[model samples]
Target: MTASARPWVLALGLLTALRLVAAMMLPPAPDEAYYWIWGRALALSYYDHPPMVALWTAAGSGLLGDTALGLRLLGPLSVAVASVLLARAGNALFPASGAGYWAAALLNGTLLFSAGSVLMTPDTPLLVFWCAALWAWVQAHLRQDGRWWLVFGVLAGCALLSKYTAAFLGLGVLIWMIAAPRARHWFRDWRLWAGGILAVVVFSPVLVWNAQHDWVSLVKQGGRAGSVGTGSALRYLGELIGGQIGLATPIIFVLCVAGIAVACRRFWRGDAAAGLLAAATIPAALVFLWQSTGSRVQGNWPAILYPSACLAAAGYLSPRWHRWRRWGISVGLVLTAMVLLQAALAPLPLPRRSDPTLARLGGWQDFANRVEELRLERGASFVAAEEYGLASELALHLPRGTPVIALGDRWDLFNLPEPPPGGRGLLIRSTRRGEAEPLWPQSEPAGEVSRRREGIEAERYRIYNVTVIGDGPRKVALPSRR
Candidate 1:
């Protein structure tokens, strides 16, 4: 609001705008391309997530003419909006002190700024709406205003539509209710109920879509989680913890831990909202805890909790000690520098464009030429991979609706009920096999396909041609009836 504040906000905005410009031009991440297909098709649900990611990409493509910039424009734009809302929400939530600025700064420098809002993923949009919704709820609670609740309703609805992960917010809210007595008083408020109904209304499309498709969305998510062996829960948990450290940065994580401890001790006993904020992150934490038991967990799965993490940190650190204020800026700068360095080297190994290591590890565009070659040779009709990661990359390289499939991963592209009947299919695998080999071989092969062993850094993919048998005894019916 002040001139000093205006410049800080503007600087953040500028930084975001600059990053987005890069994102706009940067090649689509494999996952983004896969989701882009969903957007092109305009489905209610896909094998991976609700349709919101698809809808956002489709809308961007339609409006911006479907270039790489079109695909990623929404990334920075959402983060910018989220930054604004987070500042506003922090101010409203903690009006007396100047802690809100720190909250904004902390979020700007953390993983949320680096990944979600900048990556153009479904989580970016969800985070935007999630922050807005929380801000709206704070406004409504503080003022007892129906208008804020209405806005909150819409935001919650949109958040739900963006990703089912939004449901974790409900868990957070419920935890807040149980832990903070003051929040319990709002139970009889009509606005709260109305807001709930509105959220359901806004998120209804995903539910309806899921129902029509036999809840395949649920099945897909469950399968993904289960794919990680339950025995590796500790490794998964360790990765999650390490990821949080990287994502939140040590400074903010420490602040959040202090904030939570303070809230639990000084605030939770009396203030319900603070308690609610602390409670909201539990579901995600618990899910990670459960997931850790099975397989290596991704650090980003718990990304949704960072807002609360930051909020809690802000609350705890601000009141306890203003002495370390200068240190905060120094830490933020160091973390920001690290992130920028990573981004600068994003197109690693120089102009080679074929880093098999990065490609196998989620940087498929490193072999853009190979992907392009396959698309050109195969006529871009049917491309499938044994891994979703590869399939996702193909989705980006191949033309829209090229019918990319995931074989060995229990995600059968050909399993769809009405996928183009029989087309030439290109298979990219780590193992060598004729078309007759079972997609999911019971054991890891003696070694990966010979192509993967090639000296070409990006030539890890081995291609094979196969004809998809349609409507035979062996054919798995696509879920058209569902």
Candidate 2:
């Protein structure tokens, strides 16, 4: 390793170590628990997403057991790898000005990455493989070697397995090739076609799984494309912009916007490297931008763009805007630190409703234990929840091998075992929502519990002792055993 790269290595190592410690200290978010259940029940694909996250979670938890650190073991480690790959890509693309180090630093400084690194999600693996693919693409260009195409194909395939958003990477590559005169000749390369085939091969299991399940996963995700109408377009657009700004942290967001603008200008000026980065960014960004007009665009959906965009931003800001770059990193790091502290300690006195950290992570373990106590008191055969997240959280905290069934249509599509008919269950639902009357034939309010953190109530749940009738309202044929 070069002398200059050593400091970055040490810095990233320290950050990753801190993240791992935080992972152990922090509670698992509801979605993390939900995905943990996915890890327990391995599948080629799931109702909501591909199986990569499940695989990642399973591997981690298998090694560490089902603790928070176990569930999140790979997340920080993957980000560390991603940072190195991104830095290498930046260095190869822009040799001078230490743009590589800046790219890695800026990425780690982002709230989206720094704070998110402690929680395991589909985005974790998605970001890692996405950066790996970008690095492979850079190597392919630098070496003019067909073998790198195969590596790119594998990485891209892994990215696709991680999330459907990675399809944009392929689209970005196509756009880059078409727009760059020098890259156009690669159209005749047989290896390029082979690489495309390889990606499809790697992703084929998901396709087969979807086919077996009547295309449920594809149809469910594809349904997000429909427009909700222009009446709320401006509202959703503003939210999308605001969400990105907050998640990216304001100054880093501004830097990314400026960098993208610079990259676009350079693309027109025949800078293929700049074109590559811009192409990787713009297509996905435009889709999200347009989607915001018709529907709610999730803040994390744009995460895939950051790997290449951060590199571009680093190249654009280095030397000329060094002061601004430092300021952006400082602000992002500060914001990230605050978020991490909040998630770990809940020291801030923000209202439970206003603090997402409290809303998502706080009191779940205690709440689960309370529900378990109620289940025993009521002699219930199983504990059930109307919400999937609640169900998964309960599963994570309840006694090992306890039955925690999620009562909803989405659960019918999962490979999970169905709740036994004619058995009594403790049904938990949000107090704010009306009762699910049709779900229980004989029902009586058993108890209530409040999910609280730091003396503030995040939410309240009403529990009912209900005798299940037949298969209940949300039932379907039990999914075939895998």
Q: What are the models' TM-scores?
A: 0.80, 0.95
Q: How do the residues 1-482 of candidate 1 rate in per-residue lDDT, one tens digit apiece?
A: 78657877887777787676666645566677666656656655665677778777877777786566677777777777787777777777777665666676777667545544656677888888888887886777678676776788888889888887788776676666666677776677777778788988988877787787677777777676667674555666777787787676666666766776776665436876676566756667777777677776676667777676667667566545554444654575565654444443443443225432234323444454455565576574565565555565665655444466554433433224434556655656643234355463231222223222123343344566655654322322211100
Tens-place lDDT digits, model 2, residues 358-385: 8888887777777877778778888777
Best by TM-score: 2
- How does model 2 fare in lDDT? 0.84
List the global CA lDDT of all models.
Answer: 0.63, 0.84
- Stretches of candidate 2 off by over 4 Å are 229-231, 435-438, 474-482
